[model samples]
Target: MVLIGSHAYGKLPDLPAVAQNLTGLAGALRHPSVWGLPDSHCTVLDQPESAQQALDALHAQAPLATDTLIVYYAGHGLVDPYTDELYLALPASEQGRPDTALRYEYVRRAVLDPAVTARRKVVVLDSCYSGRALIGEMGAGDHVTAQALIDGTCLLTSTAETRKALSFPGERYTAFTGELIGILVGGIPEGPELLDMDTIYREAHARLAAKGRPQPQQRNRNAGGLIVLARNRAHPHSQAVGAPSDPTLTRLAPRTVPLLRRVSRRSLLVGAAVGTAGLGGAGLGIRQLLLAGEKDAGGGVGSAPSHRTTSPPAAAPSASASSSPTPTTPPTTQTSSPGGGAPRKALKPGEVAWRKKIPATDDASDVLLVDDVLVLNLDGTLHGYDRASGERRWTLRHDAPFARRLSGAAVGSGVLCIEDENMFLQGVDIRRGTKRWGFRLATEVDALDAMPPCVRGGIVYAARTGASLYALDLATGKKRWSYSPTGGVGANPTVNDTVVCVGVLDPTGNDVCAVDLRSGREKWREEFGLIEYLAVDNQCVYTCAMGTLTGLDLATREERWSQPGVRRDPTTDLQPLTLAGGVLYTTTVDGLLTARDPWTGTVRWRFNVRYGERFATWGQWSSGGGATPIIDGQTVYLGSLAYLALPDEAAFREKNRATHFVHAVDAATGTERWHFEAGGATGTTAVDATTVYVASSDGYLYGLAR
Candidate 1:
């Protein structure tokens, strides 16, 4: 195995992530549970001075490989404008000069040389335009010898022909290689015992798509994808691991869980710590919560409805005590509705409207409100219920035999868009509860899901998750136009009346740009840092990146204001901005709901979640457990998703069930109006004039009303 990375570019933008990629990938390949390659077998070339250094390394290593020969490179990829051939960039390479770099043809010839006796060969490229390597014939054949074929070769590239590879500013590794290392180390639970090339590529592709990064390109010849690369470390009976004696290799850490969307991110049932802590801790907590569910069914603290019934029963009145700390001022009573609705007789704030116990998995999307129906996406099924009565109205399940899960969904303009496991975005008429049109995004499917699409103004703005941003007409489901940035779409598109803004991932650094809504032309672009979240309002565009919250004026397209410290901890802190009623609502890693004036960046008020003695543990406070604040009328519904912490290891083992709460706070004053406890951690919430719908991980959907 030969690993090569060039970080020092003379004139072009340098990639600092290359060095980290080399170290991390080498470790994953040497891990006992993975490839277990001997120390002498793996060769790493970091910042090679010239093409000869790399060529010499490959020549020296390829002949000794008896089973497989793997060649991996990470750096800038240049295309010769004259011949349009790919070149692997090095330290002396420039932006437009491809002659200074190493021609990729030489590398290909070395992989297919007759002297090398390796049965299977793999070439992985992590550079811009690396996919151009797949243009020509791969294996050699001869009619004189009855068309004898050479060994099959598999090639994986970081980006397509026109796209640039991405390396976020603060990320430890390049976006493409980071995901690859993650799978090799963490291992796919449902994958086969031996991880093959195709399985690895598909898993990495889906994960990148889910985060709105660039999708990779792969080319396999003569069953090349079937070549086994490593053993699945996630399997139970894999290997009894041993410590590595090599000083250069360290055990690779698990990948950080992504921020899905504003709604899905905040609606997650568990925290990042639990998500990365492995299945043991999470399983123990879930088991304890299952017992709590039984207690709720038997009339203990929680409210459980009849099993799988359409109209189960109305929940009992919830307690009115404040679960958080006491506020400086009490919430004032309001008689008139602010958002254009007549005031009716108001019930107690925590009172429940209805509760239904459905067979929902923990991976539920945000509860969606569409006209007269409430739509909820479970694993592979979509269930629609009557908004007023909580009775089941319709159901739709994905029909794909292999990719049966639904990744994400969006509802607006009387239409619903659901992306199935097959990467097909299906448009459903929400009023009639039937499929309107279906558009297949990709030909492949896997366990990874995508971010929900954005629907507005008779158009559905969707992304191919790292490839292109597309605008689809709602009426016809035909694509209006697509804009492919230098990198790929980094996140879901944020649209407005005049322009649509998106975060574009790149090897240099991610960018946030605005495009004309009608023409799909580039209006303006601001080269920003790694974009965590993107949002737009009538007057300005807001983005959170590198712990700073920046606002750009819409008409002037200039920086309005910038505020740092929004995200103190990059890994765990998620600063999702919600713009409503001219106020920018953001959450902090320390569990504070901060309301800011969007124009001047002035602080309006802040609502803090206090973890009392019962929930206290060692660590900083959480970012409201990834739940973004949802504002409706004059009320803001905030689901404080559970962050599990215990006083000791014994308590963490025995009593792992942590309770979550939904607090209805005064939108204007940031004071808690009421709070309701759930059987398990709460996710995102959807609210109407009269009721608030909450999705809980404990397999119940509660309709809380005033």
Candidate 2:
């Protein structure tokens, strides 16, 4: 195996995700000395030409047929919107000029030239539009199995062609590469081998989708056989976490300390029963699980809830019932809570409260509900509808005709705040459908997602993709203050202890700048290997970086404690860390939802969001809040779209039918209560006291009874 990255761009501000990408994937390999094959080298190239030269030399090496040759590239993959042509950016890359970048299609074909005798030739890419590396088009980003082979040539990518690939700001890898490394280092849970590319790709595709990232694409067109590399070696592999090493981390070997949570088999089995309840009439018609964390002497996760319905659900109404052209009235759901007119429970087992197709152009943003009104930002318009009836109430728009898509959105200060396509932050009056204010940064970077920015004290703290951290006055849309510690600021600004902490990343390294909210002056700055994302409470800032989960004192900026390689299951997406009930709630890129003791960084409990698949895990989303877990009361709701790679698909499908699911887990004990699988739910699920609103990529905004 060989690794090479070209991120030290001379013209473009360096693509730092590349360096982090190669390091994490290359770190776990035990070399020829350990396994005794021709040595697998991990190399970082300075420029595109240099990387190409190195790869050419590898092909020239031409040794024994027994050896397997691998090539990995992490940088920019550009697709011309007009011509649909693909190009890979080199260090000297200047988008749109010829001879400035390498043609990926040509290079991909070059790698498989028959003269090279190595039995297997693998090409892995992490860049924008990398999926185009495969000559064949992949309709879905999540799963691709090799159909035919011409030689020992195969390929894997970070994301599909239309979307950009993302990296954790302070981690050692991009989403796809990190997950690839994890799968390589940690073998399948109970089984032994983790070698097959097909197996690896399936799991990686699923993991990326779990966290809301563009699914990785794999095309093993030529490899005739499984190429096995490395062993299932396990040890206490502790990371210095690639930074200005801190005493809090160095004092203890991270692995020696016990994990805060462990997987509860009994609770999980019961949870799966609830998740699969509607799959068949045989599937239990359970409504909810027990309120978790109800402890006995053992202090274990709570038991299954008592909301069970033995009867089969009523037949679903015709699709026209909700979509028909008729004056609407709030439909009533029969519930035991108080008046039967209002819905008080989530969807009953096998029952569809209502499913209406949205003529929506984009499904990236979620549905927001406030009282009886539901809001959805679709195709440059914010459409409002009646929560109970799904009737259109109002529509707001400010974009040029058919020219806009949303990055993300939030509701605050009586306005529907949105980050628009041109990097403009706009606030629209929610009730009147009028634009209050719009602010566009001078830079060209896109502000994709970061929980739609934090709103407090009449100012909005916003972070943008092209690299900027600014505080805007909500009333006038004027910049209160601006900070750019690094060229790229992708994560959101978090406020706690009266200080604003923002994580920035570029080729230099990952740095967290703590600025005094009042003065907008830097109070302290910490440099780490990388900063993935941060969540803060009154005393601590929970950080998921360097493949480890750590906490930093909010005021002092001192490390409180750290858990190295926290999610050891070969899954890498930006793991979301949240603070609730004095415990940290986290969801991994691989679908493990966990509760941890904040004081000690000890895990309290673990629940697999993918539900009951044996030897299965989660997928990812490009970071900035799409897949982050949201806590509503004692319940945590998440949208899960899992890809199952099973030994027997028939058996697995019989038990669990839907790959796309929405689940509610107990915040206290991390026990899942109920799961509803409808059209694929994409992001943080929005809810009100009476209804759980979910926006699906399948063009429907489901109004489930809650």
Tell me the tens digit of each residue's lDDT in model 1 across 104-175. 878877877787766566778888777566532210000000000123556777775556777665467778
Off by over 4 Å in 1: 1-347, 363-365, 400-409, 442-449, 565-570, 588-590, 610-625, 640-659
Would you list the clashing residue pairs of candidate 1?
266-626, 266-627, 267-684, 347-706
The window of 10 residues in a row where model 1 has the poorest summed lDDT is: 270-279
Please name the candidate that would achieve the greatest TM-score relative to the true structure: 1
- Give model 2's clash tally: 36
Candidate 2 CA-lDDT value = 0.49
- The lDDT for every candidate, in the order shown, is 0.58, 0.49
Give the C-alpha miss distance for residue 90 in model 1, angstroms.
69
Deviation (Å) of 315 in candidate 1: 33
lDDT of candidate 2 over 484-598, digit per residue (tens): 7656664557664367777777676577777787678888877765766676655677677766788888667788899863452555554445543244666654556676767
Return the top candidate by lDDT.
1
How does each model score on TM-score? Answer: 0.47, 0.46
